[model samples]
Target: MRDRKIYILLTDTGTVLTRMIRLYTKKNYNHASLSLDSNLEEVYSFGRKRPRNPFIGGFVKEDITNGLLHNAECVIYSCTISQKQYEEIQAFLNEIESHEHSYRYNLLGLFAFMLKKEIRRKNAYFCSEFVATALTKGEIVQLRKPPSFVAPHDFEEVGDFQLEYRGKLASFYHNKNHSYQLSLSS
Candidate 1:
């Protein structure tokens, strides 16, 4: 048996960046992240480099709460993956993190998406794009659409994932002592 876990975090960050994405996407959650850990304390995504600026973004280690997303609302989805698959995910993410500075946010790709088009770049990614890529690279999910075309809501459509929690991002921590029926392996 494999001792590996994966989580997808969908958040309505309520930031200017999120609001802008929501305005165009018309979706409840405008940001997406993937975490190797169940607690979602260590999540990865491409997002705003500066808290106040929506334009400049890049690969990032996301926080489910505190800082920019402290007051955000979120839904967490959990999935169990095989050891080999999990290793692939870790390797892919490790590569990205190892040369993170070489990556940037794909603004043109995002704009193309708004127009129902796709414009992929070698070293750039957006929120959902990165998450989709991670899942595909890990072989945890097979996407019908390309990673660049994925939206935050798209993760919700993956039947393999189970909804673990849905509430304010901070509330989960406060209610952690209670039985929430979610677990992750270290």
Candidate 2:
């Protein structure tokens, strides 16, 4: 039997949350694929001009919902939405649910949904282009460099060691002999 797939629609704001979910869940899922009409940047730009109107935001949510419904067996929305905004989404979903041909829908609030059990229940889908283009180039560059460790000149006699950072404290110790320990505390 084929495993059921759960589609997750993620906003840029919820990228971190999504990554955490994927890491903890170890399930495969698809991310919402957006076209011009459903692009988040366009929605935010348009919403900025009509700050008092909820229609644009509602429409954006609906677009995401519709996009996920196209292929997913179930859907999970992972975005940082305020209570008021969440209420708006729930109302909108209810309206959509009343339609004759709407897919089964589920709303998983970003923070609340991060729980391990909840995350493990579904697979995650991510947009390759979005991830590749959205990630800061600098962060990628940083990742390529070998991590460095430094100690006072007095400890130069000690061989190389692994470095660790702990809030305001930087330390290095030899794991083999446990004969060397160097620490700098701010």
Best by TM-score: 1
The C-alpha TM-scores of every prediction are: 0.92, 0.19
Report the C-alpha displacement of residue 157, candidate 1, in angstroms. 0.7
lDDT tens digits, residue span 22-100, model 1: 8888989888888888666688999988877888789999765577766788888888899998999999999999999
Question: Candidate 1's error at 92, in angstroms?
Answer: 0.8
**Could you tally the backbone clashes for each prediction?**
0, 5
Model 2 lDDT tens row, 1-186: 221111123222223434454565454332332121212222111111123332222112323222322223221222232344334434433443354133211222222333322221121111322221111121211122111111011111222211211121111112212443222222
User: What does candidate 1 score on TM?
Assistant: 0.92
Q: List where candidate 1 sits over 4 angstroms from the true fold.
A: 177-186
Candidate 2, TM-score vs. the true structure? 0.19
